[model samples]
Target: MGRTKRKRLKKYEQNSINLCYEEHLVSLQKWMSNKGWKNHKKLSLKLFPETGRGISSKITVGANEVLLSIPMNIMITYTTVKLDIPVKNIFTIHESLALFLIKEKEKGINSYWRDYINSLPEKLPPLTWLANEEEIESFPSDIKLNVEYTTTNFKNFLNKIRDFIPNNSTLADSLLKWAYVMVNTRAVYVDPHIICEESSLNLLKDEPSMALCPFLDMFNHNYLSNTEVSIINEGRCLFYELRTLSSCKKYEQIFISYGNHDNVKLLTEYGFFLPDNCYDNIKFTLDEVLKILKFNLDNNKYKFIKEHDLHNNLYIGYDGVSYNLKAVLFIGWCGVINRLDSIIFSSNYPSLFLEKKLPDLIKGLLVIKKNEFTNDLRQIMSGRIVTESAQMVLEFVKFRIDFISEVILEYR
Candidate 1:
């Protein structure tokens, strides 16, 4: 099965979308200027039909053109927080930053970041937003686990900072969560080596490794993007195109690679998934696969797996079954291979254990998972009032299933 593609926005649709964010861009441009940052002027914020908001070219950009440069003071970093408050902090980087955003939120129109914050999404639709138990239950195991993990972190953070805020109870949990999501989705990794020598080194030492870039955050991700972001020039970070975007017409969307992240990483961290993502794959925990195989894990083979820490590194890719899966299967079905030999063979030559029927077995398993994804899609589609965000979750799951099915066909 071929993957579903994202539809291109018509010219009228683009114009309408551009009008929606024009006020936002105007306000944000002033903030950039106030902070001494330089805008390339060749780029503009445009709405992509496929990826919502993205940066687009206003003119023909050449190879190695520096698109934008954000000053260090403009970034929301651990240093930024420290400069605001001289008192030593007990909170971790993320907690402190979340608190910083909450403070800014409390300031309303008085806040220096009012323009940027106002432009932020009023509602972040991560699993955190799913209030009903039924809605939560409908998600797949992997997505459910991600939600649980992030929720736990959020709760822990709330506990630590609850006493710090005056009238803390007045602060809505949803606002803090939205701030947290915003930081997670937008922050860029700033390396220590790139820090300019003239800047105050005190904050740099205590600063978190990540910092949020204002206008730069608007660049949507593409796995095949030729643009690269670097912080080496002076104290500022710049985004530049590596290849000449000759193929891209005027106003065409240009993207930055957020590292070759898979669909799961993108969805969990950024609240969106790429349609027909090339990096898409089905992940299976060892215990889940063991349950599927119905293998009693108390044997010496299982002990060997635990001793070497091989049990955790297992999954299925779009290409075929993972090597770890083959090893465990060989140990379970054909015990002639000892633990070490099986491990070595699995690492070196997994194809040796590929059975004629293994693909069919996997196909059957994938079908079961695919049905689960499709059933959720059907439930959402048939609803009286379903959110577009909820519908996106279904689309992501359907893409995963379709990708798995494509792999299954290749094996057959």
Candidate 2:
């Protein structure tokens, strides 16, 4: 039965790919033209190996060439929502956009944005989709906590806004949540107030400045991508292109940097993570460290540390553990050894904290984090195909553990 489910999933994926080739790309171009999109002749959407669908060039795209120039009138923004959707009061811009998307999605082919809407996944593969509570809990505490928080927030938001929708409106919690995430992940920041007040969305007095750009959102994220998106024509228009695409060969995929985001940020917000991410950091909280300590800290010591902001300095980056983390641990150790004189501990502690005992304490903390990560990886690998979202998270954990293990070896 499990094998059959896997086979079915594989077949669906192949069909989805085929559908993109045979229908989505062609229809998308036609729809965009009908909607008055300009400056997209040189680009074409194509599915590449490993990476999913992204815009590619048939001919060589020169540096500084504007690959896409979308007019302000066509963008899905606060103005579009205020005019089209009948929802009386939107608490936030995201909820407003999510409501609009849900209404349009229910319209099927009748909706003007049908082609683009259909191109989107029926549902995202966010960690919120994990069916088993245990599977969700198996993730690192940070990740698990984030997923729960976001899920709870979505549910609360949906409940708050659903009453405004008419009884005749079709509002599914799942679809509404998916639409919310779509807007959250794909929307780009743009100061709509810069547009002429005549064309601006004045009704939404408190709405955030963001817009959903078709075709542009399709580009996958690359931390090192040279592409830059900028506003032009008094912020009434937006354009993006590769800054150094002169070296790119024909049919090569063009990418854009989402932002200088870490793995945790990416996975939580975008449903993906980068392996060996240069920005990756393994964090340690003071609470966890306190729990792991063999000796109980006295009230005076705890109060002093808390008042002095001496907690939660631990973090492991690409360059191994941070020095601030070592200092905090050393201070705690000194307290444990009854050598923590308030005046002496405060003055020039960097050299003082580098004692022989410090490395052992740091090593022990690293080993504990490493073991936790190793146990999580074993459970993930032993399960059925974890999919890219889960796999990326697992790989990120493994990468951190490996880095920590190497740091421990350095202490040898």
Candidate 3:
């Protein structure tokens, strides 16, 4: 009985794949005709033999090219409620509705819009699969309703695009507007997975432009990978590449940038600290040093390491860590004397300063005992507190506020 059931499930899955493939091909042909492409057979030959069984295709208009792919086999599982009926029933309803709309559009029958909106009540079954009547009641009724509404909304959008194309607008412009509409309306979600080629053209211009490829449109890939291709007389245009098997929802952080190099530079510049060779044993008049530190602290400029002729290449040790102590002290002492809000410390080893040494230094400064402070500071340099380093850094920042305030008052 188990083997029989497995065989039946395998057949059902294959049938679903075939249905999706047929529907995709039909939609692609209709989209091509709508765009006024005359050589269907020739173009079909160029685009035929898709890279895989999935909904994927490449499109070229004049010199512009784009690759599109969709992951139709993706499963969305809802965990809060379980129904006695199989989940595939719900999937069938959604898939059937999508395929029906595509068919209606190809037949050029506008009335299907009204029919689709009105037919939702009869098409969707009740939540009889739920374990209890109360569970069914708690299920979101609006979600089921919105699914139908979204179908009608999509029909209206396609109609608008069809109208816009006949008005002599450029295909690229029309496709761009349509992509933005699809995204903003949330009718389809684009997967965030992206793979950018290093040699790609720079398409980030002041105004937006995008070319549509029907195969790419199907997948809803969120991170639109733009590939640069050079064409005669037209210069360079960005093309969308084929989608990968990876899933975007798994990653916690998403970074989108117009270009790779520019984004990296932005990250590094913001995190960089001034080098240590800028300060040495330069005698400052006690009054002068105090004033400089105070001004630097007030402006949060303690992290700015400026090179001075008097202290060229000289470095000093602080908290048993080798740093330009003169530069660090200048910044820290200024902040200490001025009672500044939010002192910014930039260091090449910011993680080290925060985690290992800064906490003990602050604690020692507050108590004004050199020997106790030196003993605690030694533990950091010797690597005994390596495991708790990050935690210590966070705590040190929290503890420094009181010490800073006290030092300012004492100096005043």
* Most TM-score-accurate candidate: 1
RMSD of each: 4.6, 7.7, 22.4
Residue by residue across 48-120, what tens digits does model 1's lDDT show? 7766787776676766666676777677775567555423444555666677787898899999888877667
Off by over 4 Å in 1: 1-21, 83-89, 125-131, 192-207, 233-249, 294-298, 338-352, 355-361, 371-389
Q: Give one digit per residue, the lDDT tens place, for model 2 in 226-334.
A: 6666666634444332254434455667777788887888888887776545666668887777666563677877776677666755776656566556555655666
After superposition, the stretches of candidate 2 with alpha carbons farther than 4 Å from their true spots are 1-21, 34-36, 39-41, 61-65, 84-90, 126-130, 195-207, 234-247, 293-313, 323-327, 333-361, 378-400, 406-412
Q: How do the residues 265-318 of candidate 3 rate in per-residue lDDT, one tens digit apiece?
A: 211211111111111111223233334334334333432434323223222111
- Scored by lDDT, model 2 comes in at 0.65
lDDT of each: 0.64, 0.65, 0.28
Against the hidden reference, what TM-scores do the models get? 0.80, 0.75, 0.24
Residue-level lDDT for 374 in candidate 3:
38
Look at candidate 2 and tell me the lDDT of residue 129: 35
